[model samples]
Target: MEFIYSHNLTVDGREILLHIWDVPNSQEQAEDGSSEEKRIQWADSFVLVYSICDRASFNILPLKIQFIKAAKEGQSQEKVPIVIVGNKRDLHHQRVVSSEEGRLLALSLDCGFYEVSAAEAYHGALMVFHGLAKLIPDTKLALKKGTGIRGIVKTMSAVFARKRTDSL
Candidate 1:
């Protein structure tokens, strides 16, 4: 099953509205516009979650991250805010993927990491969303600055370029 949630928060003294898409890992697509490609396009940021108790789920994280990265090939990978989450933290006794492993993977991928249990405590889940929410605005601000710098460079280049003769 898939779930969607809306969150309202203030970041940098400005109100932001976020639509969180809790897309479950599945090969099947329903009639709705929930296909992987469409979902990837719809997302401004991503929180990819895997079950800590399931090794198979842990194994798929790299592939899933790569898919999102590829789908956003036009943007620099670092600009995309992706959080790696290992869910079912309360199932530590049954865990096949260690917190250390999850942490290392997130470090290597340059992503924020969290281990939370949706079935256990709501605080952990809230922290994950809030952390990512903060990151989204920072990423957007950086992109805007980069674009602004490029625009300035383009304008300067046009000014310095040889002028065309106005002969009709």
Candidate 2:
């Protein structure tokens, strides 16, 4: 099951829209819009997540990271920012991946690494996003355009106009 949500977040005092998708690994669903390749392509910044308790989940990241990098083959891979996250810090007793290993992997991938427990480290989780938000360009102007009723009205009008055109 894929859990998708969008939320407005305050990162380092700046408010921004955060779109998150918790996609489980499956070959069947990996074929379309929500695929790893498409996510890497569409994302301005990426948070690639894995559970610390799941060794297989952590192991799968290298290949996903490689695929992400391969998508930017002609371009500079460093231009694409990625954050490797090890979740479930509360389950550290069952931790299969060390923080050092996560750090080293992040270093090798030329990205950032963070370990956070959604159940406990709320600030730590927020900090992870704030760290990434710092790397992104200011989206204030674009975000401003998306707010309020005017934008919604314009969107609805466009859809109606398109439908009218298609019918004729």
Compute the lDDT of residue 64 as modeled in candidate 1.
75
Candidate 2 wrongly placed segments (more than 4 Å): 27-34, 73-78, 139-168
Which pairs clash (backbone N, Cα, C closer than 3 Å) in model 2? Answer: none
Q: Taking the tens digit of each residue's C-alpha lDDT, what string does model 2 give over 5-108?
A: 56577766777776665666764245673345555544567788889999888898898778777775545545666899999998989999999889999999
Work out how many backbone clashes candidate 1 has: 0
Error of 1 at 8 (Å): 1.3
Tens digits of lDDT, candidate 1, 38-123: 66765678888899999888888888788778877566655678999999999889999999999999998878999999998788
TM for every model, in the order presented, reads 0.73, 0.72
lDDT of 2 at 67: 76
Candidate 1: C-alpha lDDT: 0.73
